[model samples]
Target: PFRFSALTRSCVVIPCTFQYEEDIPLTRGIWSKKTGGIVFHNGQSNVIDHFKGRTKILGDLNEGNCSLEIDDIKPFDNGPFCFHAEKGHDKYRFNNSCVFIVMKSPEKPVMTPVPAEVDAGSTITVSCSVAHTCPSHPPVFSWSVPDLSSEISHTLTSPGIWETKSTITFMVAAGDGVRSLTCTAIFWRDKQQAGTVKLNVK
Candidate 1:
């Protein structure tokens, strides 16, 4: 059994399969979310309130398609989930997991002085970035500057799949006040939605 992580407001198709010495009297397949010390599962044709209407079993059970489909993902749902099957008086279990991280549209990007503290008129580079969601959808960067009026300046870059550093840079006055900065990332075949990181400069 295996699970995959999905970003907030995204979708993922988890692959599932099972193996055994002989065909047993398989009764039911259960998918549960591990939250705190509790387990949320679909049993007796009912789903736990927390996961109700959010979890769906995709594919055919008779065909052993225990895969699950979760949509409109949220950070809270990120976890190490357990998938189990029952056969007569015996049971088999597998741990399948994926972590979902939430990043919404940024209103402004954060600006930090290179040294964390600086004097007026000092040369400082303000940076911005977005969180990684999945392999298919990589993060991008953008910025909002006061001098541009209503226009936003964007510096887009390829996904750093192998590198840990992903950031955009800007040189600004140390005395600048109330500046808005933003980091944005877009994806999906439709290219409809994105995540943002916003900051307010003081």
Candidate 2:
């Protein structure tokens, strides 16, 4: 089983691999939904209209790669899909080998600096935040600064939505003229989004 998470209106790649007992001449490949509705077909003649121009095979079939790419993903695209392969007079359906796609909204992180301008030897706090609906799979936060002291917290902003905030505290030094702090938010399935803020030391 495979799982993929992607932002709405974005593209996602569903990786697939298969092996057979004996080497046989490859014929075609097909991806279908749980209801046996064809999402994609190698011949392109029987492809469902909903996925006609939005889906494509990413890997070469001759090399036994049947990965698929879906563009402009929508909420309706979420669900389980399986792959089917065909060889000379032999057909194989991988009902067990399925992929589930989850769709989410893309939220860019926001960086806010307390005391926008800091003096040398003074401490300042920079906060990076993002709002997401998946509380069960909260986003992981990371700062670009190594060995930086930080604190993380989360709040329930609205129904099914959560706001995560990471604050980094640091004292400005003469050597730290102008520095940039980058915050990366990683969601489930390795979906990563980031934002940055530049600190001005006066």
Candidate 3:
């Protein structure tokens, strides 16, 4: 995985992949800081105030997906997070397989075909997309064009980058000459970011 860039008050999924020869069917997951301190473990979780009950294993350990999910991320939760897995008689810690979190501010959504051009009585497709670090809880997308239905898809384009896109097909009618096409990315906790573009119908 890569050093993940995240937004404050958002969530992040630290992709923890490792190889082990444990034959056991179950494994215990652990998350620690780069400085060798246990932040979370399946045995017993005794973490800082900011991390208590905010972290969990989002992947199946037996399937070799030890990805960790952290919710309601704060500045105090920033770190180079590491993972460790252990089964009955086998154990291995990911010393180098760690991910760092980079806190970032919010940004507006991107609308393709800037100054969206449309045909008054023809069919057209337009899309709006945005990037976020949290895949477990993806950002919700909404469009301003009420008559057009949107199809959204999510992709993990990179190690720590997740993109949310909304594709809309419109059957242009005899509407006004120009109007606003607004798109909004709605996050958890009622946080939202919007981008609007005024377009003319030919």
The number of the candidate with the highest TM-score is: 3
In the predicted model 3, the residue pairs found to clash are: none
Ranking by lDDT: 3, 2, 1
Q: lDDT tens digits, residues 1-202, model 3?
A: 3577777788878777766656767558778887766767775545755577778888788877788888888876667787877666666776567777888776578988743567777776778888887887788888776645668899998876799898887776777688777889887545689988877877
lDDT of 1 by residue, 1-202 (tens): 2334355655444556655445554676666655432222446245655566666666555566676655555566655556676676677765443223334432222333345334444344444433332333343333443222222233323321111123443445465454434433343222332233333334
lDDT of 3 at 111: 83
User: What does candidate 3 score on TM?
Assistant: 0.83
List candidate 3 segments past 4 Å from native: 88-91, 114-123, 171-177
- Note the residue pairs that clash in candidate 1: 106-196, 108-181, 108-198, 108-199, 109-181, 109-182, 109-199
Candidates' RMSD to native:
10.5, 10.0, 2.8
The TM-score of predicted model 1 comes to 0.43
